[model samples]
Target: MISFSALGCTQINGAEQNAATPIATAQPDLAISGNSTPNTDSPNTDSPNTANANTASPSADPELSTAIFAGGCFWCMEQPFDQLPGVVSTTSGYTGGTVENPTYAEVSGGSTGHVEAMEVRYDPQQVSYEKLLTTFWHNIDPLDNRGQFCDQGSQYRSAIFYDTAEQQALAEASKNEIAEQLDQPIATDILPAARFYDAEDYHQDYYQTHAVRYKVYRFGCGRDQRLSDLWGAEAPSH
Candidate 1:
């Protein structure tokens, strides 16, 4: 149920002729565009390249570690972990797709099998994976399969890409806690971490660079309102 631009395959199950409604699939769709490499920018203050900043293995150093989570739009997802005390940086990217290196257009077109994701690099000593999980659950509607906010594609579905076994255990614990608290099933998946392709230059730090457009999009998309309805006081404050 994701809206797409620049393609004709709209609404996977539903047959409608419109640009906004793209077909959604539980299975990965084959991408014919072949492999395209994702651009890796050098680390900076606002956003650090996690690959350059930390361990080759995603398990993280005692000082630096990485956590990948897909919660709706990566634009909205980056700021939360970025503002955290020990968080080194957050990068918006794509994952859980069939394509080797997917572009935003390919993903948005529903051909890449990739979903919009955010990678958070943090210091383990200051902030535990548990805290990161807490932030994640509050920010997303785990029960929704249709995607997040105005976006309604499998690409935007919520997921947590855990890099290590410890992350998996903690993520499971957190999900159990949320399920008990909500007394409902949690739809978010705890999948193994995969290669995180950094999004395009313009897509990075979108909240800061495009402040007005970000706010307008956020407001229009109804992300805050939906979070409030779903989380109440538990919702994270902006």
Candidate 2:
């Protein structure tokens, strides 16, 4: 197991120390208007652009492909893929929402139309899309439509945003497989790829930075145990 320190904590600096800081419980007031981007002074931290520049450089492997997913709180969703062998990077962010360049504050408000999502850049040659979809299913509660686990509202909805027709077909097939495997009908939505806005820097790698609190949140929310019950032998451990 990789220690938290070894996984990189620079992404979140002062967050852990202020773990007790009360995160705003009130949802922000946001109105989803068409496909228009939201007006905000939030910094632009495009993950794909950065990944294309950093990992897609001449020296890096060229077989990798990118996939975007929204499965509730991105903090929890990011964990499984981050541990996967062939995944190059997993960036936590927002997608499928109407508000453009939304902040954590805005998205949490339940009005931004954005679901907390992760942008996964991986080597498809190494890890198949089917495997990634399998990992995604194990990490989230597909039975819940009112958001995932403890988190409620649209921001936490489960969605698989496909980047291509092949991805779309695979996503649908995977969902069907799950539906047959489980007694409950799968509730995950298959949506087309939308403009994925990378979250603010502070929201990235939140679990690694706030390890203790994240553990508490995960445990208190019963996310892992629920997944274990659902996925049985396939569930990944913390």
Candidate 3:
């Protein structure tokens, strides 16, 4: 069982409410390794939902496409995609559940069936979905069935919510590849896209708004250490 101080984000943060004043940096601490080479490995045809219809904050630009992935805490999930070039915006949210507009508290309870997820709007012309998949795989522990890092519960389970058939195919291929590469069964789910509700305003960019607390909680939760242990050199910095 997870400890009181490490009961995912809420309880853990409550313990250190007075830690330090959060300082918002003008820029993210680290950037994703620029891999501009478009992934020809997967089919790139436009599907019905390929446009910005299914996700929150739909981009007016038709060129921008959205991809949703649940990789533990939405806080850690945003930074990786935010650092990438083609990504327009990353919204922390809850999805893959029956509830509508589920709150952080509800999801954190582990009964909403909604996992904390990130919705990434990016330009496919600049960064391919396959590249995003690569970054996602390297950042998460695909073999973990319970949850991610120190967070235990369905709310923190890793998942890929694909919006289109092409994405579904690519996701399946990538999952298979990763399973083979690791020689282990991956527990991350690849489900069809569901209604994604934007998390509370504060949760949008918790890492940025609560930098000090985010860092302290993240380290204390052993997120980075586990990533390094599981991913080795492939582990993402920041």
Candidate 4:
């Protein structure tokens, strides 16, 4: 396994620290609104432009389905779903909050009542919703009510933002199964999904675009280590 130096991970500079940091002051583009251009500013920061909302791709394919999940940092949440065979796309954003068009800074500050979340678009025929739920469970610490891994605060809490009654039932069932298996109370929430505001362009596909910094942050955050401890062999590969 590849291991990162503690100094390297802990010393991640600038906007690489966490999502709550205020890195941009510009207005963000609305994904559903469809009014923003691509951002090419600091590679590590969350640029206000290039938002993708709850639905990342503008695909009109009727077979595609959408699911939203909050597993602390949205960056870490993307890789797992992206690797799945049927997943069409993933968007890192804010949801289940009262604020509209919230920025990374505002949502991270915990005042917007928003939590950092990922909106997943997938094909049901290719992959089942139960499979997506399983993947979500393996990647996060369901017991951590405060947050996941090193990131804390309500903005980083783990949750399932279900859009349909079927999804709610599945999510609740999954949550109960996990709680019973672990013999512990599961802290992950199952809530109705609200309007999902796409995060800055820079935040999307972050693990791919900013590889080194992403690794450093992931290692420093102790995400994988905690996952291994929580789920053991069931843990998703990092």
Candidate 5:
């Protein structure tokens, strides 16, 4: 069984107590940007000087790159990529669905064929796509196709939606390498990128908007426990 003590904070936070509370920085520091966790636990606000400022802008830089991934909860996926050094931004969104502009309720209800996903925009000059792939594989449990951690259903299933043929090859190579390393069959899908639907505005920077609740949900969901069991000493501590 997975251990509960691995969680950084075992208590439910203020976000669950009041929606109006407006999440400040995540306490006990569970986030990502340069690594898979940010260096600061400051409340998310719009400012040019903020460390993770680019995650808010929808406008793209021709030079930047994009990768879409579904690793269970969109909330959990954002932090790791956000903290990566080369990552320009991470957007919580939906993709690999038949529906257009699917709402969270519709997607969560399993009627929209949509999965909770994140769009990671990065600078290849700072971080290689291969490195990003490595970060992704380690962060998720490729053995679980039914869902990720506590989130159950098709929408929560893990997938790597590649936007380019090169990405597909890289993802497949990464998947094969992981399988060989673990000596087990990998369940993560390597599929063509689909039309991505940006999630609601409020969902952006959710870890910061609802830091307390994010921690509460993460701890209650047994995410870290499972990750520890799977990755052993190498598991990223979310």
Candidate 6:
């Protein structure tokens, strides 16, 4: 069994928290010059205003790029990225493990070496990777080498799974900047991209699907308070 005292919160894997009381970025617009076919790599560059006014031809822009982040519970990570302007979708999942198609039970068992993570599909033009990193750094407790917030265990450790050398450099640069800004040293890891296994269906869109439960868990766990304490004025509005 995991110890909650070490982290100062209840230790439950990805399980929903019990019901309780509730609680509660600048980016440039990219312009699309031509009618380009959308793909994962070639996302439409048009700004939101000119892109799509109707539901039928939404975005009229290119598909967005993706960034995977492992920061404590996937549920906590999803909402922040989802709220960002350029982020198209944030899918909670597992990564950095040797096992393939590992189930939640297996991962929670703590032997699979996988950390709960979120794959963020975002439009790079609308929101630069640097901005995303800034948003991410603010959301997580980078000083917690063991795990994030109230969660404790290797499975809950923080990490950035970079897909390219450029990404790696950007992540490292961001971490260094954070270190300079704060007195405490940051512990978030920077690693290469690993095979990301989509979590169980129930785990998908957790905040929206289980808004009440998520709010209680976040409040009781002290995620926002801790983040505000760490980031101060730099903290993003949640």
Candidate number with greatest TM-score: 4
Query: Please, what is the TM-score per model?
Result: 0.76, 0.75, 0.79, 0.80, 0.76, 0.74
Model 6 quality (TM-score)? 0.74
TM-score of 3: 0.79
Task: Select the stronger candidate by lDDT from 2 and 5.
Answer: 5
What are the per-residue Cα lDDT tens digits for candidate 3 across 91-182? 88888987655656667767679898999999999999999999999889999999888877788999998988899999999999999988
**Cα deviation in Å at residue 72, candidate 3?**
0.8
On residues 60-118, what C-alpha lDDT tens digit does candidate 6 reach at each position? 35566778888898878888888889898787778888776666656666788989888
Q: Across residues 72-181, which tens digit of lDDT does each residue of candidate 2 receive?
A: 87878777898888899888777877665665655666777878888899987779989999999989999998888777678888999988889999999999999999
**Residues forming the 10-long window of minimal summed lDDT in candidate 4:** 26-35
Better of 3 and 6 by lDDT: 3
C-alpha RMSD of each candidate structure in angstroms? 11.1, 11.5, 10.9, 9.1, 8.2, 13.7
TM-score of structure candidate 5: 0.76
Q: Give the clashing residue pairs of candidate 6, or none.
A: 43-62, 43-63, 44-61, 44-62
Off by over 4 Å in 5: 1-59
Model 2 global lDDT (CA atoms, 0 to 1):
0.69
Higher lDDT: candidate 1 or 3?
A: 3
Which order, best to worst by TM-score? 4, 3, 5, 1, 2, 6
- What candidate 3 gets wrong by more than 4 Å, as runs, is 1-58
Candidate 3: 10-residue stretch with minimal lDDT: 43-52
